[model samples]
Target: MGSLRESLNRFNKQQEKCQSTLTSIAASAAGSKASNRTTTTPAPRAVPASTLSKSPVPAVKFSNDTERLQHINNVRKSPVGAQIKKVIDLLFESRQSFTAEQINEACYVDVKGNKAVFESLAKNPKVNYDGKRFSYKSKHNVRDQKELLKLIRTFPEGIAVADLKDAYPTVMDDLQALKAGRQIWLLSNFDSQEEIAYPNDPRVPIKVDDELKQLFRSIELPRDMLDIERDLQKNGMKPATNTAKRRVMAQNGNILNKPKQKKKKKTEISKRTKLTNAHLPELFRNLNG
Candidate 1:
């Protein structure tokens, strides 16, 4: 029992010495700083909520709608002014009511994505939109009142107000003004169901001007007109009346109302006259008083 106790005490003392040595080694290692030693501790680099909350916020970019509008305004004031004027003139001259899409088609513009041309057209005083469609005010009336009267006098077949309205919606107003002034007498077939007339119909006869007359006359009669009419009758091949008129004018510019060559009459010589040709000397003899 004495040996057993001595062994236990010795074991305890050895354990205590070992623990002390381990503690001393740990302290020495912590105190020592080597030139090439790497720290095992991880760095605390995450952004804290307090620092993030105080940082400046970035600015946002926005579209300049005013600048876009100003750009459109500038386009209106440019040389395109003449083009717009011409388009307006055509709407009246053709006596055709045009929708926004039609106007764009006439101008060779694509208004599906582009708004400038459409917005510009809306600015005209005569431009009125009936919810679904757009049309001009003075479609049927000639811009010059004198011209309108002259045309009516020349072709007394008289025009439908709707036809004129289609070309120039203000034609009725202009004609009314003329009536009020006692300048011209106009007739309407409006009440007659036999003559169908609509508000947007352009009723004026497509006039054959001297230039067009000359152009048509230069070509052989029924042939040229037939060819053109037949071509125009084709599906999807028909051009606007105004476009067709212009095309004809362009093609026949230099050619005027020159007459076509007629077939010559062939005369046959008489058998007796052929025999008389041989007896010409005998025919010269007798002179009677």
Candidate 2:
């Protein structure tokens, strides 16, 4: 009798599951018929992030293609959707931010409507706004590994990683991937965190006095460098790191200057000179003057 009671309980659960399945199917079928009968546009359904997940292959399950197109038309007719579409189209044309005025002109929407859509959509995680302009947030717009490397080279003091993440959330994984590969470095001090992609470590910006800048005008070798550094240290000077040395070179506006090639001394050749003249070009002889 106990075994029979257990079997009955199992059957009741199975019956409930079957009823739930039938209810879902019937609801879907009824939705299809309602979509076919309705001529008016229904409210736009918000597509969930789960629905947008990338799939390897496309699958179309419903026969609601006509209804879908009509819904799309309704979205286009709606002010908010139309404005968002304008922003998308503008981004496709130019990834640069579009000003409210520019969008109003191009999309032919009134200023008030444009402002409303911009303010609303600006809250979206994927929409980017700069107080006055709008753009679609994209990873490509953010500094990639190569660009971060370039930034490392440019700003030797290092870039705040948090600031970079704020600018490009999409590239967070890319940045982490590069970090994992040891292609870049994440560093921190007492107050801040930064990324350094260049091989040379970045140093804090320091003001170099003219005398020190003159001393490091050209790179000094170990002996001269040690002597100069020792002498400067006696005067309470900080030893110049590579970044400091570069800053000095840049302050003088010649960091990018190529080393001056030694000019061959042109000796001036006398028109009436003999072998005693030690023949050389007249220009060479005149170089001493």
- Tell me, by TM-score, which candidate is best: 2
In model 1, what is the error at residue 150, expressed in angstroms? 29
Residue 122 CA error for candidate 1 (Å)?
Answer: 12
Span of ten consecutive residues with least summed lDDT in model 2: 193-202
Q: Give candidate 1's whole-model lDDT.
A: 0.59
lDDT of 1 by residue, 200-242 (tens): 2135535568998889788863455556666667755664345
Residue-by-residue lDDT tens digits, candidate 2, 137-228: 74334446666555545655665665566444355686677678655666765434345333343354456899888878777555656666
Model 1: ten consecutive residues of lowest lDDT:
193-202
RMSD of 1: 22.7
Go through the candidates in order and give each one's C-alpha lDDT. 0.59, 0.64
Model 2 Cα RMSD, Å?
32.9
